[model samples]
Target: MKIVNKLKYIGLAMLTLFVSACEEGFDDINTDPNSPVEVPASTLLTNGIFNVGYTYWDRDLNFEFGELMVQHMAQNEYTEEQRYSFATSDFNFRWGNLYSGQNVAAPTGGLYDLSVARALVEENENLSDAQRANQLAVIDIYMSFGFQTITDLWGDVPYSQAFQPGEYPFPAYDAQADIYTGMISTVTNAVNSIDTSVDGFTSGDILFSGDMAAWEAFGNALLIRMGMRVGNSAAVAAGFGGTLPTSDIMLTFDANQDVANPFYQDKVISSRDDFRISAELVAAMNAQSDPRLAMYAMPAPGSTEIVGMPYGLGDGAAFTLKNSTSDIHTNIEDDPTAPAYLFSMAELEFFRAEAIVSGYITGNDATAFAAAIDHSVAQWGASSPGYGASIAYGSSNAEKLNAIALQKWIALYTNGVEAFAEWRRLDHPALTPSANMAPGVTGIPVRMLYPNTEDGTNGDNLAAVGTVDLGTPVGWDN
Candidate 1:
């Protein structure tokens, strides 16, 4: 009887083993919940935010804006004699391409969609107290930087509801004035709130590799830029309610040299064939004896000297043997070696000079202006032999300002939007419309028209903006 009991127990044990084997059929498959959903904040930040910023640099939108602005400022006509096309008549001034109304989405909208700020705000909720604080600080700085760009171009935007499509599907437009004020306040607070105790920095910050110090400097630099933007408007400047600090936000572009510099490498469109330098831009560089000319424009293929034709001239215009083609080219679009600039030491110094001249801060305008020129030239790889000479600063304030504007123009050859904004503010190196410009389109456009897409999707909001003449001066020019 005892033996029979033992045999029955053995049979039961064998059956239990067989059932367990059937349940664990696949040993290699993963079932952990944490492993599948877990993505590092750094990866999210880089792939999402940095990638968008790099896109802007590659598109050459900035350079196109610069050409239009500078040509108008110089009062250079695009007459038929010069074979010029595009912006001959005022009606032809199309700002829509840059803004991407309904036909396409613009960089301004794209930035918000993939902003590290939004991601951090949403995902960091589960982080520890210290981690959460650091993450928020990073978001604050990035958001301010991008929003500032929007306000600088368009006076007003949908900021309150911006990036919150889920919450407010259609946000009312915020006044440009209000947006600027909020930007300053938010950036200042974020810069101050960055926690030094956090263990790891933000991983995908393409501009600043999660470095708190760099982020702080970038924030301050943006502040200085904003301060100068409103410098001409005492009413606007005063409305800041004393929250905007007077301290200058210093920044540098020597990322290759300074580990703290936030600049990073961006992918080039092609080994060759990106952008061509516009005739309008090249002529300006040539006239000023700008040292950065060589770095900006190469001699047309098969020629040693660079020659630029006027804007109004079409393909029919005469081209010297030294000139490449009669067509205008964006530097970044064409040159294989062209570098993309985010912010640079030269731009910072220019802001400082402008700040001093406008009484936003205290310093020698002339000295600061000269330093700005020097830094700009140096950045263009001008120090090498066979390169162009450096710009010389004259003694008087007017001469100094001229030098600053000239160099700034050269530095901005690859940066169209900035060049256009500067031309509106200073009206220097007078540009005229092309004599050959299309009929009825007279002079350079002061501001881009709202994209036509707004007409259909956000008709009410579009109407609220009213019909601003394409020729109407925007922001700083006012």
Candidate 2:
């Protein structure tokens, strides 16, 4: 899965010289081929941040796998994902575009570029201790978030020796248990490392232009998220209470399609209208009279009704049903700049409700549940009749827990990966497995398959590693 293309090794000077050799002002004698040019930390930071959730992540994680399995949407073409039969090659883009990367490479991963940015900050002679701390902390949070998410999705992965190509060309896959433990430490360090005294100077801080409060909250939000992922006994109490209010960390898009939300950019602006709303999601929303349904999807063409496509239909079958199924709404579609909620106050409220459900904290279940619903509505910026009156908070804590999980799933429409992770851990809404699954694919997949690159480049390491099936849960799922 380590496919960097070695393109980053090709320096800009070499390309320029090769192209301009016939130019009159070309001076091969004065140019030093050995001189190394480093890209600025600021540029790398923005690029890394954008790469994390945009392009590949949106397609592979959000649409291809997460949304399909979660029943948010079904693929209209190929439809292999809807059938729950995916190939190893289907996941190769994750490694090449997100998990594995090299310096200056096209499609550089979030952690790879961010870690490179961190290195630059650490090595800069002019930076003060506080300045370095401020910059490094941001990278640390992103690195930890990327590692945590990758491991959550794929189980055991190359973590400790992943970025260090010189030391371990074919890094051994780390165990999910060990990876989770390490991520807790890494995220904890990042959350505590923010130094507000020094300015986070930059020209390329796209997510949050040097806002220390936002950055620190982002780190804490990540910390709480990771802490909960592994079911830490003390995490609920320590990570919640008042902390939930201010710990939202997210990527906001402008109202312009020029730089709108990544998914918005791909589907609406790019005109890749390949996905339609899933019947499961639409039916559930309609049953509860959820007001967000209108904001989430549009009516079918030439029809005033809003319906979703049946889950896991073949391409031909879906084509026939296309007239009935709804597409994404203009609220999200026309407004290309709609914010892609990575982490938000609404999610924090759900965590609070979950903590109470797990007995990790003491709070009124109904109160917390209501708060979560309100937060979710506010997060969408859509007016609603509200969930309190219709969607009842059940009497028992067990029933409440199911409600909380299912409600969270509904609220997490755009954040498909996180929704999948929560489904694996919480097991609510009871998603049904697709009929007539593909060979080797079991019920709805709990984990992603390793890429085909491992079979060739690291066959020995791949062999030594344990088996990975879609049905098998990761280390933290229990």
Write down the TM-score of every candidate. 0.70, 0.87
* Tens-digit lDDT track of model 1 for 1-478: 0001112122111111000000111111111232222335454444334323433343323433445455511112323322223232321212222221111211121233223234544455567766666666666666566565555665666665443334444545667666767776766666566665563254556555666666666666666666666653332233222233222222212222111111122212222221234566667667766666676655766766655544444433433321354223233333433444556777877776766665666668777776776676776667533222334667666776666676676666555666766766667767766565555556766665554544544568747866675466665568
Report the poorest 10 consecutive residues by lDDT, candidate 2: 17-26
lDDT of 2 by residue, 199-294 (tens): 775666777788765677776676567767787745445556323335345665654554466566667767776678888998988888887887
lDDT value, residue 185 of candidate 2? 64
* Model 2 ranges off by over 4 Å: 1-37, 55-57, 100-109, 241-248, 253-260, 268-270
